[model samples]
Target: MNFSEVIKQSNQVCKVSPDGKYLATCVQYRLVVRDFNTLQIVHLYTCLDQVMHMEWSSDSLFILCAMYKRGLVQVWSLEQPDWHCKIDEGSIGLVSSRWSPDGRHILNTTEFHLRVTVWSLCTKSVSYIKYPKACQKGMDFTADGHYMALAERRECKDYISVFVCDDWHLLRHFESETQDLAGLEWSPNGCVLAVWDSCLEYKMLLYSLDGRLLSSYSAYEWSLGIKSVAWTPSSQFLAIGSYDEKVRILNHITWKKLTVFEHPAIISNSKAVLFKEMEKRAVVGSEDLSVHQLTVGNSLFSTQSKYEITQLPAKVSVVKPDPDHANPKIGISAMAFSADNRYLATKDDNMPQSVWVWDMQRLGLLAVLEQTAPIRCFVWDPRRPRLALCTGNSKVYLWSPAGCVSVNVPVEGSFQVQSLFWHCSGGSLILLSKEQLCLCYMDTEEKDQSTSSDCNFTI
Candidate 1:
């Protein structure tokens, strides 16, 4: 695949619309929206200050840009290009902002978490929720966009707040077991909510939408507590990654431990684990470790007793050297499922030069990719099976079953590639380095067919 460089400079990270038709990025003090296929500017808005952050509405009809110097936010709609809405926090300043799942409301937090403001586009009004103290973790909106959950500190205690999105009314507020809450997340199906204590405590609490605590879990005292939590797409199982180098899957129905996946590198910490639910199977990827494919029979209607978990054999193995100063610690740094759910990518923390791609259907290694420099991160196209990987030397490698292509991004000073975002159609990619943002378009059909088969690998 050949990639043509589009935008060479940008202020902040770029975001793609949900449908992959448009790309939004901040060019200094202006927000520029461009056509994903043509790389032509379609809409541009100049803000009062440099744009610090940008988020697209779920429906891809609106773009929200946050100003850096001033604590202000600007919302732009595609239908009305001349008219725009502004959100400002007078003295406190805006700390962060989020768009509701339904793309109807905008949520903003004041500087120091002094308060939270909910802005509705349809009503053209705003509501406020005062905070007694600053919260480390912010609020979360359910997948269905009907409810919002957040943790607040009140009078030396931490309480979880659930709000109804329709009227922005406080649905319920309940005190958790520990006042030191760390995170809050609602299941994808919007049936349950999970809250966990900070690393100081190993308690994980599950609650219903009505604020009733359904179950609580604790890690062994010797463990370092839960590092991260992820719910299966079906909301039937919750995977918790602990510092003890083990991932525990819990059945929501039974509220009991279903199974545990032990990683090979005990010293390598797990930042996150991912689960991809396919037709009749599920793929689990553990950080710095391995990937397991399980045959989840009757996952939709059955309980934990009826599920089957199987660990796939090692398709690709890394050579581990003795732990010494010369050989840095090794672990799985990153992993992602392809858009089609047929390929899986895994990267090692120490060996950034290599990446492993697995075929989920056949449960085997598909390809092993090696690069000139250590890989910083990689993202799969949301609409295609193509993969884009960024390395430490400011280069990106695009891979597919057809072939592989590498692009070297020009750099002026000392900056590294930070992240990458793909347009919904998988034709455009936005690369954010430390200093600038760039846009690149991929032509999958125009690549040299003679060389396409040269990089092909089969297992």
Candidate 2:
């Protein structure tokens, strides 16, 4: 893999356009647009305030910049630069804003979850949705973007409202069985809606499009419950991560637990490949030259990383959380299914440095990646089952069926990759540090290249 030069960004990292043609980044109050392939400046626009959030329209013809603190949202058009629009929430105090599915409307949720205001750009009309509850994921849109599901609270009862995106009209409203509805997600096929309760209750209910409860599942009614959940792209399996450091997979047809995956500190499974990241710094002499690539010593601070396969019986580090703490550092806090639904990657907060990969076909452990530092983020390639992650360091780690490899960002040891995301095309990666970002171009010819002899390929 090769890396491009580092570029400056804001606290809000840049985003790749949904259509995969443009890149948008905000530097303070300025928004910069660039060609995704060439990385050249395409357009620049100044916002009214420092952008707290940035989003691209569904059609990729417009950009939305939101300044919640200012209670303002600005929309810029790519087709006509001069045609810009602004919406002010006035005294309602905006907390969150997002683009509607059609990209012709904007939805702004006022502070304290009072209501959701939908502003139509084409018709110049406004719609109001009240009683919006503030939860982990109170709103979700189906894959086709035709319908939206929102969790609502009214008179201490948990309710769900399904609305049609075309006219923002309420389609169905029904009370849910959840005590404290934490989040809701629509299935990829848009036929099922998964509503999960707060961590205090171990409850998950599947509802049909017409607000009918299809099935309900609860593992146990004790301690903490669900922390994260994800659905396979094929909509065949639903994986639920709980506070017990276990993942329960449910089949789409039966809506029953197909299997349970446990994250153990001691990894002794012979079939599971264990990879340990090793980092080293290269020494450099005083003499150096860089005009036309003459003899020059490498920077002493430049770090290189590689993955080494460890034998079985490896012990991963575990930090026990204090019981008196309000939010204990335990359970499977992060879980993601690969795009192809062949692999699932998960992280247990208590085991801060280890990542577990599970094989969906066999429903068993596949690999374990133990990084030296805590993992900040991990994402899957959009077009493949490849996985990439970062540890708040200057390197990006990748794992494919072939093997695992670690590549450093070529910024002379200045850029640390705190988080990263793969482009929509899965051709490159956007690595973000505290206030800077860069691009990593994966060599297409060796996109599935094998790692060193020390590494072990799982598939």
Candidate 3:
């Protein structure tokens, strides 16, 4: 694996263009755009306030930066370097900013103002809407880019307002039963809108496009409510990850639980036994095995409590800790489904060997990687059948069904790999460690060589 050092310095935030041609990074108040392959600087712009957030247009032609302290947002285009547009709110600073799906409009939320402003790049016009002050991220656009859902507070009541994309007009507003709405997300097919409350509430409400409540789910009293929720690409299943250390899958058709997955508890009767003959050839020592037994009971949950969901007999899968002494007991912290939805990758909170890849269809363990450093995050390529794993240290491992390849990214100062981005073509990967951003060109020919290796095995 060969990676070109793009920026050796630390950056506050970094993003790669969707098309994978340009790499953008924000350091202090400077935003630099560079060529992905050559690592050559292309465009550079300095902001008045430190750029807190940055995003690229869908077409990858324009770069947008949000300045919270100055209450301003600057939109810069690669095509027009000298000409740039700014969205400034005088007294109330901008709290958050996002790009429309079409990349023709920019959305800005005002700090403590209970207002949201939409700016159109084509018409040079602005539209304002009332929003809830308590709802920090209570807005989302559908995947198809036709409608937008916003949760707002109206006269002490919480309501979800739907808007049309063309005119940005209110289509309908439906009041929600819960006053504290935490987050909003639209299904991949743009059929349903899911809204959930903070940890205080155990509610997950689903609504249709017309703002009608379709279905609702709640966590059990023993569980700590939901930590995150994700919809399958087909929109047939919804996976809810809860603080209770369980993953529950919901059947969208019936709006009920279909299956439950949880971390396996240690079996009291199971013992670590090694034959006298095999002990001589063993790679691990008995002392290590004894330590593993001592830490086996350190799981986050004790007794598994079943929650009611239409009384359907749920298919359950339990992920057990690795039996090997080299691996440690750790809770799952990050997970991602492959773009094809055929594979699921999960990583533990603090153990390197806790990364497991599973066949989503069969719900069976595919591979348990032997890692060195603890993993920070892992992502599957959107355009290819490959996975990239980022570790707590500045190391990244790329894996396919056949074999794995690893790379150690160099850092000038104390830093860790914060994020990874695979190019749309799957030919390159961008790694953002602290303020430094690096790009590696993936050698496709290695796939064949890796598959032929004796150590390589298929999932």
Candidate 2 structure quality by residue, lDDT tens digits, 403-448: 7877656564467788899998888889999898888887655434
Model 3 residue runs over 4 Å out of place are 6-12, 133-136, 265-333, 347-353, 369-373, 403-405, 410-415, 446-459
Candidate 3 lDDT over 1-459, as tens digits, reads: 565644754344878888878888887888889887776889999888788899999899899998888889999999989989988887977888989888889988888857989899999999999865455468888888899888888777788889998889999888887747777889899989888876567788898888888998885764346666777777877777665666677778888987766643221112111000000112333333211111124332111111111111212223445648642343445667778877666654433344556666766555555444445668788866688877555556666666454444533334356778778787777777775766766666543543311223221
Sort the predicted structures by TM-score, highest score first.
Answer: 2, 3, 1
Q: How far out, in Å, is residue 310 in model 3? A: 39
Pairs in steric clash, model 2: none
- Which one is best on TM-score? 2
- Candidates in order have lDDT scores of 0.67, 0.88, 0.68
Q: Count the backbone clashes (under 3 Å) in each candidate.
A: 3, 0, 2
| Candidate 1 overall lDDT versus native | 0.67
TM-score of decoy 2: 0.95
Order by lDDT, highest first: 2, 3, 1
Least accurate stretch of 10 residues (summed lDDT) in model 1? 301-310
| Candidate 1: stretches off by over 4 Å | 132-136, 265-375, 383-388, 397-416, 426-428, 435-459
* TM per prediction: 0.72, 0.95, 0.78
> In model 2, which runs have C-alpha deviations exceeding 4 angstroms?
285-301, 446-459
